[model samples]
Target chain A: MTQVALMNQVVEWVNEAADQIREKLKSPIMVEEKSNRHDLVTNVDKETEAFLVEKIRTNYPDDHILGEEGLGDNLSDTKGRIWVIDPIDGTLNFVKQQENFCIMIGIFEDNVPILGFIYDVVKDEFAYGGAKTGVFLNSQSVNQVENVCLRDGLIGVNGAMFCHNTFNVRDIAIEAVGVRMLGCAGLDFLNVIRGKQNGYISNLAPWDFAAGVALSEPLGLKCSKFDGSPYDILGERQYFLVATQKTYEEIANY
Target chain B: MTQVALMNQVVEWVNEAADQIREKLKSPIMVEEKSNRHDLVTNVDKETEAFLVEKIRTNYPDDHILGEEGLGDNLSDTKGRIWVIDPIDGTLNFVKQQENFCIMIGIFEDNVPILGFIYDVVKDEFAYGGAKTGVFLNSQSVNQVENVCLRDGLIGVNGAMFCHNTFNVRDIAIEAVGVRMLGCAGLDFLNVIRGKQNGYISNLAPWDFAAGVALSEPLGLKCSKFDGSPYDILGERQYFLVATQKTYEEIANY
Candidate 1:
């Protein structure tokens, strides 16, 4: 299938998933701890992931799937066409605030990032694109972000990482004009992609940042591990960082 | 005029002012520095303040106005009916991100906070209320926030303050589950008022936090200086802090 047609189909599936979440939110959501009390997963997360997996399997059976809720295939390697999904990127926010959460999907061909989609369900902003398609917010095309330095722009840091000075993120926050913590990686990626903030740093799983890296890398953003090394695509809980070109250089050197 | 009627009128005027801002954003905004390069003010800020002040003066001529743009009265005491206004809270966000900024206004009678309103223009969420009216988000009535302790809640702190550990805010950040910095005071206040987060701390002027204090205090949130002392309403740049009942006690004692 053509990339455009594939993207259109995926968008439809995502919209349907969002509808399910919104409907479920009207009732009480059953929440459970994933790793700890601070780490959460709701029933909506599993439901959304299941629905998306069903749609993908029915149409693109050849493609491998890796999803957050474990409803998809158990892929050992990042080979061939792989779809990475995080049904609810900010599960804690989804359960607590019922906002600031997102649905994210990344399409990779032969371990090379191609197309991606990050949808803010409550705000109704669907950011999608990749190298070939470029980037877009809904209907409007997004341009490459201006190269701003860390001293001149806002940076989003993981709340715990910033406080604990992990990976020297506290030093980066001190250098930036300001720091923001939205508690959602997808929304943070959207802000960086749209030039709202210069960069973001967080420890993330493959599904958590696959879509963001695909969307941002094409927009002149630099994506890597916290120490400025290239990150493994299918790695677990890598210290992820994405930033404007100059800001990236500044942080990496620091 | 009755409090409800007065609130309706103010809401109308605020809506009108928001309309003006939306129209003005279509063109290039004129930006200026207030205290430093980081402290910004825009043409929209001055224009919005002037508009609100005019409406208030025309409708209630006896009330004094104290506004961020200096388009209002110079009050030495909080003795009479007074309207405090921050034309555009988070001017940096307005100048750069074009989101997260808010219009805030507070009413006081004889040193007592009577009513307050905070309008998130881009999101179209208008939060308004006081001791007598109870808090509200648009048409829905908002209930008092649960008495969550610092360890179980997210806290919003001024970015610089958190980094600098101003007024022992670093200790508070260590106690909370997480920290967020939105760069907009009014939006932070709205989040705290709605129980989305448990607390926020910043150094602010009367205009910067008056409306938030008015709306939040009525919902059983505690408001005070960062040092756990009573704050002066007409004072300049007091270390302002707001949190849920239990969280307040926790932070105050810490």
Candidate 2:
């Protein structure tokens, strides 16, 4: 199969995995602490990651995987094709509210993203993309969203970004018409795709953003470090995806 | 009828009115600009408020009404039995997303809140209360929620609150595990009742908060000014409704 064909297959596989997870999510799952008591992981997270890894290994034996919850192979490099998975993004939201969580998967070829998918299980929506195929929501291709200005736009940031006096996020927030921190990076990425927000910034791991970056680039989003540098996949960094050219320029200057 | 009976009657009336609005919401209504281009008011909002006002007038001839979009009486005082209404809280969300908005109504008897109701029309759920009766969701009375610490709690605030540098909201948000701004005060209030959030703070109109205060008070929530004082009905003050007694103290100190 061509790389494009492989990306499509990956999308299908992730969709199936999402459906499986959603079915079991009807009942409460066991929750455990991760980095802190506030940082939660559930049985669903581990089970879903294991399920996805098993399927990928069966289908694409050569491709490596990196996933949260340590279900996937330990990766030395992003060489060749690698699948980065976050079985349950927004675990806190999932455990507490049973909504706003999503399944995320991103395919990268030689450290460059080739495909991204974020599925909102509760809403039954999926956002997917790669530069070659452009961005899509479900089966429909999305329009190239216009870049809006920061003063007239909605921006998303992490709660910590806005607080703690670091990065001066408060000043940045003041310039936008609105600021939203939905507690889910995948959901926030979807909002950017829908034009509900001009951009978002957060401290994201590779699994949290790999698929989002794949979807965003082709949709005309300017995804980069807070200082407007290229995204480094191996390094966990605070980055933003701006919707409009004007907003990107404004934020960069700010 | 006793005061409790009267409040029940009002609740029933509001529920029916909410149902009417929800049914019509199935069809796309014309959305127009209000205050500014970004601010929207839909035909559904006007129609719903009108429907509610007509019901209140027919049922309680002596009661005064205050409603968003000027569908009800022009009110200068909270004297007597006053019904404060926001036919659609989160009007922008209703116009765009069609999910996060809600119908909010608060009945104040002689400047004191006697009843409050917030109906999530799409979700077919409700949170309601009055001074004489405790808060309830659907048919069950909500238990007095335990207090949570800010570091372990979720909080909801208006998006603009974070951006505007008002009351140092950005700093406050960093102290919580996560923060959310879902665009509807009513929904935020419900989350607090569900224990999904420790508390919420917003600069809201009376209609936006009247019903919420009613529901939150009986749920052991500490609803007060940003400075931790009693909330004023007529003033558009920054208010906080903390989930736990401990959370309230922690935030107050922060």
Candidate 3:
């Protein structure tokens, strides 16, 4: 694969998808309940996912795709060049606030993450990068987040999990200065990449955090399964990403 | 007091204070703990309070003032024209996220709220209003919100209060589609007034919620004490605001 060439196409495709998302938001949205009333999906989510899938398939016909809206391939293994996309990461937020929702894309080649993108459509904050190059917020190259301790920084938690005290989230929340539930996984991790938030703990799907892991590692951010094990980009699991090693260890105590 | 003239001047003062706040956030902040590490106050908070206090005193010397930063008068009674200012409403948010914090101003005459302003400086979203006229987001007039039920719309909750299940927040949270914790009372209520959130429940001080009452009443939103009593802007207490009357009653059940 031509690494830079593939990255360029991904970036272009992301911007195009973002523009389409803004256009779709202008119309009255049609929402449907998914797993429950709390889990939602809009026509825009499906349409956006289809758009991304079509673009990838047309450009790289041999590539495999897994998507939130299920408009792509049904695959059990991450064997070849594969793409995972969440066209609208926070559909409920989009329906209610028309804000904070984001579009995320992650590309893996032979099970190794190669490219990633997270676009906050409302804020026009595009965070994208890969392991070969450091992360970039918009156009500027970035570094790791500040090493703020658990007692000093604000954290974003998965609201449902926190409410259920999954992984003892209530205890972790208490150790942190404050908790924020923005209701969007992509935007929450965007805050972590920018150093605005110290960490985010959640039970996420592959599409929910693939882009985040792809963009985070280059910035020295640690993405781990809650037990401090290596994170698998292909699985749906509980995960936590911390700004620094100190915060990672402190949070693990809970 | 010439109510219109005072309102215009107050808007001007609020905007000027917001400008200074943006400037201060760019520099290193000096944060001090208040009630706990979770409760923070910054030098910028004190300076901004002093700035607003000086402006009010110079413009209206006889007016009494109650402020979070303690840069104004300490009169216990709420008689006469008075102002309440929370220089930095989400002090911890300001110190950590550097976003979501707000400068809130509520002015009252003889225990009746007159003018209120909630400036979300980072987003450049200014929400202001009073009893005579309707509420406005930025410069556009806003309505009383969607009138959606607790089961349909999003709700903003105070982080610490939710953690403690204060007012049975966990139960209240379950009744809603989702929960958001923006950290700043001004920003939280701003979401409520604009129809983005159906309700917000909190244990807020007078300064933290006085401006919200002043703005919400004009939009016909309900602001009540936890026991379903009329909310008093002059007193600090537990309160909730709802978009629809049905929701108002439904939330009270929790």
Second chain alone, TM-score for each candidate: 0.98, 0.92, 0.94
Cα error of candidate 3 at position B231, Å: 3.2
- TM of each candidate vs. truth: 0.96, 0.85, 0.96
Give per-residue CA lDDT, model 2, range B77-188, as digits (tens). Answer: 7688888899999886676556668989988887787788888887777878765787778878888876777777788877666665467766776677778888788888
Query: In candidate 3, what fraction of native interface contacts survive?
Result: 0.86
Candidate 1's TM-score: 0.96
Lowest summed lDDT across 10 adjacent residues in model 2 chain A is found at: A235-244
DockQ for the candidates, in order = 0.65, 0.43, 0.84
**Candidate 2 Cα misplacement greater than 4 A, ranges:** A2-16, A19-29, A73-77, A129-141, A164-168, B1-44, B74-79, B95-98, B121-125, B129-143, B158-172
Q: After superposition, how far is residue B92 of candidate 3 from its true place, in Å?
A: 1.2
Docking class of 2: acceptable
Candidate 2 per-residue lDDT over residues A100-162, each given as its tens digit = 898999889999888898999887789887888777888898887677788766778887667
lDDT values for all models:
0.88, 0.79, 0.83
> Candidate 3 chain A — worst ten consecutive residues by lDDT sum?
A236-245
TM-scores of chain A in all candidate models: 0.98, 0.94, 0.95
In model 1 chain A, the worst 10-residue window by lDDT is: A227-236
Q: How well does candidate 2 match the true structure in TM-score terms?
A: 0.85
- Per residue, candidate 1 scores C-alpha lDDT tens digits across B91-120 of 888877888899999999998889999999
For candidate 1, state the interface root-mean-square deviation in angstroms to 1 decimal.
Answer: 1.5
